[model samples]
Target: MPALRLLWLGCLGSLCRAYFDGPLQPEMSNGSLHHYFVPDGDYEENDDPERCQLLFRVSEPRRCGAAPGGLSLRQELTVLGRQVEDAGRVLESIGRSSSYDLDGEESYSQYLRREAAQIGDAYASSERALSELESKFRQGREPEPRDGARPGDACLGLLLRARALLR
Candidate 1:
């Protein structure tokens, strides 16, 4: 189970890198993109309230741009998709682990079921968000860059720490 989980995580990591780190397409270039970043009070200046809401929901309401991490909408969606995939793996691991039990406690099994359901809900939410963001990107809307670390920076650190611990 552990081996399978590790393999799944490795595949997911590679997929994320491939999807987000690919060469920038012509439509993704600076001039062709629409900026998500706006100075404070500048959101109101824009005519597209829906776009503002979609791009800025991941950010603090008061702030107009990406979080301190410079996470554009596309990158944020990718991170969210990665997180969903990870969570699905976790749920699958739990299910697989539970299946090995010859005489599992009913309460424990019930708990696992509930947890799996919750994870499913979360995964669905992440998928929906990713879909929405991708739709926006397909429409030529791009998240503006802001000052800070890149998206998934903390996740990378955590993954590295986990690898070290596993070793």
Candidate 2:
């Protein structure tokens, strides 16, 4: 029928095709797509292992850091929990002597105790995950100095000085 012929002609007329004299992938060379990023050596730098390969659209193993971080907030909460426990322990210990001396001292004590309890609960909930991260972190942790002083000891010494300052 003329209607069917017209429809086919119209469809063919509306359709379009693109063509280029050069190759499909201009940047491609040596039959590898690496040409795209190879020009910018910054992205393909093999020396910096810390650089996230994901940014370069490259599939390579990367150290996400001391904590395995991908949508997991446990590591963040753990750090917060440690800070909370330390400060709360110091505050609660200091306030124990005269918890009733201040007007809101009772409420303060209750609040700190409740907060510490909550932190404990959080840790208990993520104990398994936290333990797994702990092992991985210990393995990835930087080697201690060959000298007599260890990095952890040095950090602890600094923390002790900071506590002394707080007192």
Candidate 3:
């Protein structure tokens, strides 16, 4: 049951395969704590992750661009939150599968159990950031911190990933 708890809390660490690689960073609202990120339009440069650059500081949630798609940063934030929730479901399965191991070695099932716990912690942190960012974004206010902290010009953050790209 503790494993279940861990799975519920983690942020799906490095091994957690991505179910989405699209433009996770969308433009945010004015005075937002996020930035607008888009493919540098230099796809011929190989569409490398480095190509995902900050386009501009986000505006109000209502006016933010959605980067490559029609989805605004606000909407995309919702999508990201849903994705995190979905990953938790997969982590839950992993925790359940751990029940099959009869081995006692740390490299065995117990190792997986630990991973599950770690991911749960990560997920919990991510969930908090997501929810907080979303709520503040909707209200068109500067994020407090740990999640909604304002950006470069005090208006950049993809709510989640745009911060990296914005850099």
Specify the highest-lDDT model's number.
Answer: 1
Off by over 4 Å in 3: 1-64, 67-69, 103-167
Question: For model 3, what is the error of residue 30's alpha carbon versus the real structure, in angstroms, after optimal superposition?
Answer: 23
How do the residues 71-125 of candidate 3 rate in per-residue lDDT, one tens digit apiece? Answer: 8767889999999999999999887666556344445666678878889999999
Off by over 4 Å in 2: 1-72, 99-167
Better of 1 and 2 by lDDT: 1
Poorest 10 consecutive residues by lDDT, candidate 1 = 53-62
Ranking by lDDT: 1, 2, 3
**Backbone clash tally (model 2):** 0
Best by TM-score: 1
Each prediction's Cα lDDT score?
0.72, 0.65, 0.64
RMSD of each predicted structure: 42.4, 33.9, 42.1
Q: For each candidate, what TM-score against the reference?
A: 0.25, 0.17, 0.24
Candidate 2 least-lDDT 10 residues: 51-60
Question: Can you write out model 2's per-residue Cα lDDT over 1-167, one digit (the tens) per residue?
Answer: 99999999878777733333443442333433332223356654654444432222332243464444443467668887999999999999887755654435457677678778889999897997889999999988967567687658978999999999999
Which of 1 and 3 is ahead in TM-score? 1
